[model samples]
Target chain A: MERIPILRMGDVLLVSIQVDMHDRLAQTLQEELAERVVKDRARGVLIDISVLEIVDSFIGRLLGRIASISRILDAETVIVGMQPAVSITLVELGISLDGVRTALNVERGMELLASSISLRTQE
Target chain B: MGLESNSKLVEVLGEKGRVSLNDWKEAQWAAIKIRREPITEEELYREASDFMSLFQQAVKEAFLSDIRDPVWLKMREMLSALSISRARRGFTPTEMATFVLSFKQPLFEALKQAHGTDSGALLSDVWMTTVLLDKLGLYCVEEYQKTREAIISRQQKDLLELSTPVVQLWPGVLTLPLIGTLDSERTQLVMERLLQKIVDTGSQIAIIDITGVPTVDTLVAQHLMKTIAAAHLMGAECFLSGISPQIAQTVVHLGVKFGDIVTKATLADAFGLALKRIGLVVIKKSGE
Candidate 1:
């Protein structure tokens, strides 16, 4: 089983999914990300899925689950670089991913996470 | 009928081809004149001559009862071209069918002259002529109908493209002004175009101004929400603008909840909010 590499940028965990994710891979990523966020004391998780061309209902739900798990772990998850077609498909599939924060690209996702973390600290 | 009458019909068409073509052209000219059609005499002559030669060749080679046979391929192609051209030139189906049916009278005259003594052969030849010409006339009408349908479908596609235009208001702001009813098909097109534009321009804000949209029912409201959700999924904020009081009432009555999505009474307010979200402000310059 090939493992997806999760890079850490400062307090943010960057996960760029360049390959198609199957059930096992997504499940592993979810479990590993939860463990990594706790161990590394990461404040945010940025997921880049621009190269992901196809997303079924399973992947959509997995994204929502990942976001919820990160939130519970005291880390914000911002999904970034979602393609237009993927977003349209997700909407058509009626998977709104209600609680997840999204951004246009990695840079915006970082800015979002940084501001959100700063806001929480200010509060 | 027997093959003799078929050959006899061909023989009369071959021998008196000039006179029959002349009569056919005269009849077409009279009809065009009466209808004040803009067809030139030379164009009519050319079309009649081309059709006459193709018809003669096809009748000689193929069975008279069936024009769809491969033997009449050239004839069908010629008629399809003629029918489509006439259809584009604003010719009615009756006028197009008449262009083929007018040949019947002249050919009947020639058949009378050739088989006058034998009423049996003349009657069979006339019947074959009528059947073949009627089939040809109907083929023209069918082709005309197909052309009309092609034109209508093409216009429908063109209208779809023309209606949905994604315009960029500022560097990171885009606006989509919908001008008609929001059916599923139109909504799908608008959503696709708006999403693609958001990706292409990397616009952070999108304003959908429905000022030109006359009404909004539950279905339309659902479509709007879906579009906004899709835009949000792509990381762009969406604003619904230009809601009239009546539409607001209808939306409230329909129990359609916009939830946390922003709604505005006009595009200007939406634009102002969009600018503020992107950290921009429009202020008038001080004049001397």
Candidate 2:
């Protein structure tokens, strides 16, 4: 069974989806992400998908679902590395990813996650 | 109208082509009834003369049935060039087609005078000429339409680029003043341009000015939100300016929520907000 590796750094879980994900892989990643959020007590989840040039509605929904699951588990999720074409495609598909936080790249994603998590802690 | 080996239409036209060409030129020059004449009479005469000579040479080398033969290449080139110019000069498709069809009259008269008193032979010859000339006329119209489409598409691209101008007001601040309808195509263009500019300049703030936009419906609002969302993903804050009182009422009545987006009534207000966000302030001098 192929599984997406979830790397933990301090209080954050970093997942970079570098492979072309199928339905099964996306499902597995969603389950693993939810479980890791609770087990590791992660404060934030940063997902880098800049290499993902194509984003269908299914993958778009999966991102939104993961954001929701993380929010429920008391962790903030920030999606990063979205290509310009992918952004246009997602918008065209009417997938707003309303609850999902997005950053330009991993570096900016880290900054967004750190700032957002700090804001949450203060609240 | 079977002619001897040497009496092919091509040879006949070649031998007496100058006479046929004069009649064709007169007929063509007189048929310029278009309100907006694209070419002068002299220019038209020159083109007509050139085409007749080319046609005579083409037919001399190949049968009329083989319209795509290499011999007719020059004729086709002339027609294509004429079609494009006519399209540019605002000539309608019918008028452009007429330019080619008018040649048929002189060719028929020349053929009749050459093959006098042979009714059966004249009918067949005229029929062949009709088919050939009709094909050429249709080709001219087709080329004219193609050229018009190309011109229209180029102008549309120019308009899109003109409407979306991304100006860097400050080091980390960019402004896009939109002055037209926000359709899906233009929205996509705006998003790509704004995102690329953000990456190029590393600008963290973008102000989209819509004061010039006539109206904002639900769909337009959605496009605006999508653009702002994409910019947000890029770690840049997007501010929308130029919300008039009527537009504000329309937005609220339409139940469109901007959700944490900073909206201002004018570009100046948005600029001020952008400046404040970037921690830049301009104070009045002691004695301005």
Which candidate tops DockQ? 1
True contacts kept of each: 0.69, 0.38
Against the native chain B, each candidate's TM-score is 0.92, 0.87
Classify candidate 1 by CAPRI docking class.
medium
Model 2: colliding residue pairs: A50-A81
Candidate 2 at A97: error in angstroms?
3.4
DockQ of each: 0.79, 0.38
Q: Model 2, which residues run further than 4 Å from truth? A: A1-42, A54-62, A92-94, A105-123, B1-20, B23-46, B58-74, B89-95, B111-128, B249-260
Q: Each model's RMSD to truth, in Å?
A: 2.0, 4.2
Q: What is the TM-score of chain B in candidate 2?
A: 0.87
Find the candidate with the highest lDDT and give its number: 1
Task: Give the per-residue lDDT of model 1 (tens digit) for B1-288.
Answer: 325633477777674542377778988898898877878999999999988888788776655577777877888898999999999989999999998999888888888887768888888878887898899999999999999999999999999999999999999999999998889999998999999999899999999999989999989999999999999998999999999998999999999999998999999999999999999988888892
Of all native A–B interface contacts, model 1 reproduces a fraction of: 0.69
